[model samples]
Target: MPVSSPQIINMGCRLNLAEGESIRALLAGRDTIVINSCAVTNEAVKQTRQAIRRARREKPDAELVVTGCAAQIDPASFAAMPEVNRVIGNAEKLKSEAWEAYDAVLVQDIMAVRETAPHLAASFSTHARAFVEVQNGCDHRCTFCAIPYGRGNSRSVPAGAVIDRVAALAANHGEVVLTGVDLTSYGPDLPGSPSLGQLVERILHHVPQLRRLRLSSLDGVEIDDRLFALLTQEPRLQPHVHLSLQAGDDMVLKRMKRRHGRAESVALVERLRAARPEIAIGADLIAGFPTEDEAMFANTRALIDDCDIVHAHIFPYSPRAGTPAARMPQVEPAIVKARAARLREAAAARRSRWLQSLIGSAQQVLVERPGDRGHAGNFAEVRVPPSETGEIVTVTIKAVQEGKLIA
Candidate 1:
């Protein structure tokens, strides 16, 4: 439904951001668009709610829609709000009869394991970077995660469809990042058991102009020799990988039912480094789970320090209501906070070390937004001499300042 005024909002992750942009295109005829959502932590939930209130104040009678994971998981709370006209879960609001009532609509559909082909064409991103969701849903039921329950099973759109979308995105001067609930799980139900490597090869071959093709999080256990070899051959593939390492302690990993533990995870990172020395590796770490004590937390810190990780996402364990970890003995908030502080310090140190390594090295940077001073890239911030916002520039790192590289 096109309205003289319309706003769409999203919460959480790059994958969710991509879907929100798609929804914006679907409702493009609307004169105004506002996205009010994100759900990384409880704090993000507060930020999203405030964004919704602000949007209501700005566009009093504008059509409004609230979707994505946060809205899908908790529609009733959103529906009770005075500003929300309708709340649909997943993408179900697109099919709602009540959509006619307001100039805008909100949909909350049950997260499905699979996705039907999108009816709308791919969005031409105005930003230098665009994210393409190659897969959705998770088959692994991690004890601490509510993701499998929120987003059904693993499913993938056809490889051809993904390439077509990338082509369109590339035409608009954007680098494409393949994202999903678990990107390594892509192509499970698709024809011929197409591998993630095959998908990367196809996209690189077809869309040669694509500035960069980055992969989202992948499972360390699933990293095979074939995939590693493909990375060496495909120069377009980004040298960065964000492996999901929820816990480094074996007992904690077993409780979480993660497929891999510290030893194997460490090996995978080593393999990647051996194959590509310049690779930037990152991982996700959880602190203070039900099974995590000071010893377990220490083990995690040691593993991260030894793993040669370029960066880390440190999160305190939040017990989602229905997860197995929630039913287990919960950690004290005080303990979680302390562990998180330690991990944050470690992560910052590693990030600074990685930035230092980039000094005097030339890197291809896809310029994002123009900052007050200059532009930001994957590695560091640069003050381009008379920098233009959208252009991709090659620059040599002149120095390492604080935690970022200066060019």
Candidate 2:
């Protein structure tokens, strides 16, 4: 990749965005620039094409090398695009390269891990919080996902090394979030010395002045009594959990090849609530899978209502290339969009109810950004009298005002 005025572009989820930050740090202030690509859905792919066209229009002959899961899953398709000069995939771009090429090398040597030498938090995004990738890759075979194809088997960075990274971020007074493809499977490759829970405990014990510790999306299948107990014991850890529940209908769960079913997932939620009633639960819901019809959608809606989730990252089903669901007859685009809209509406209602319930209670709120003369917590954005940034203060929930709780 080569250009007179080069800039990096990233597309996809937080994980991909995190990787893009790492890549930018790898090639910061250089004449050459790297572009992180995405393959989340068909619409996303189209958006990527439009973005590439726009990038070319902005900077013709820019050193635009595309990487990430999108490039990994379908390199030739991306290679065919006119905007892309080079496509690297399958851990090939993990290494430092002076020259550009279309390459896909499946490298899984944790020992050969590409450290940007001085690992730094993403500079582009808001600095209120930072997420560090402690684990990479997946072992589960979800029918609709392209992640396993892009990322190989589970592997974790050494615990001491991870602590060092967290310490670096803490020194800058940034909140640290432990993230991964499947965080539950963290520390599997290494000899069973310390688990993800152990890592958190170590960080909490050592870094006493750390602002906050958060965890990424956790799988329900991995949750047990011990983990829930540990969560109750830790006061510094945020009470938000982003559990990915693809479907609430059992048959749909089978079709999606998800590990946990409706009943078990519900049980897990109940246990969490029992342990910590104030714990804010977050969830992901995918609507309009191949087997999902009106009744199935109703079941999903009811389940969401039952779960009483405060925040939802809802997505419509879209098949990616080389995945099992891609071969199956996809739900019509119109249906997918409609169900997705309904789910969003339901999620909004749930959040409103949760916020209403929080009124007349006190919460230890961390002032992230100065909003329209207010502040927000790990849960809802609460309006406050003028306060300094990074000020962690307690506020009594007064009422739900304009989609935010007033304190």
What is the TM-score of candidate 1? 0.90
Candidate 1's residue-wise lDDT over 1-407, tens digit each? Answer: 53453455556677776766666665656654444354445666677788778888988877556655666666678777887665545544333243344533344344442573363236735466777888877888888887655566787879998998888888775467788888898786898998887788788888888877778888877766667876655667767778899888999999988989789988887877887887777789998989688898888988777787666888888888677888998789999989989988888888787787778888766666652223233434565444555566777878876555667
Candidate models: Cα lDDT each: 0.71, 0.72
Residues 40-158, candidate 2: write the lDDT tens digits. 67777777777778887877856767777666776777778777777776466655562333343322332243322134344435445666778777878888887776666677777
Residue 282 C-alpha lDDT in model 1: 79
Candidate 1: which stretches are off by over 4 Å?
1-6, 31-40, 93-113, 116-121, 371-383
lDDT (C-alpha) at residue 91 in model 2: 65
Each prediction's number of clashing residue pairs: 15, 0
Model 2 Cα shift for residue 177 (angstroms): 0.7
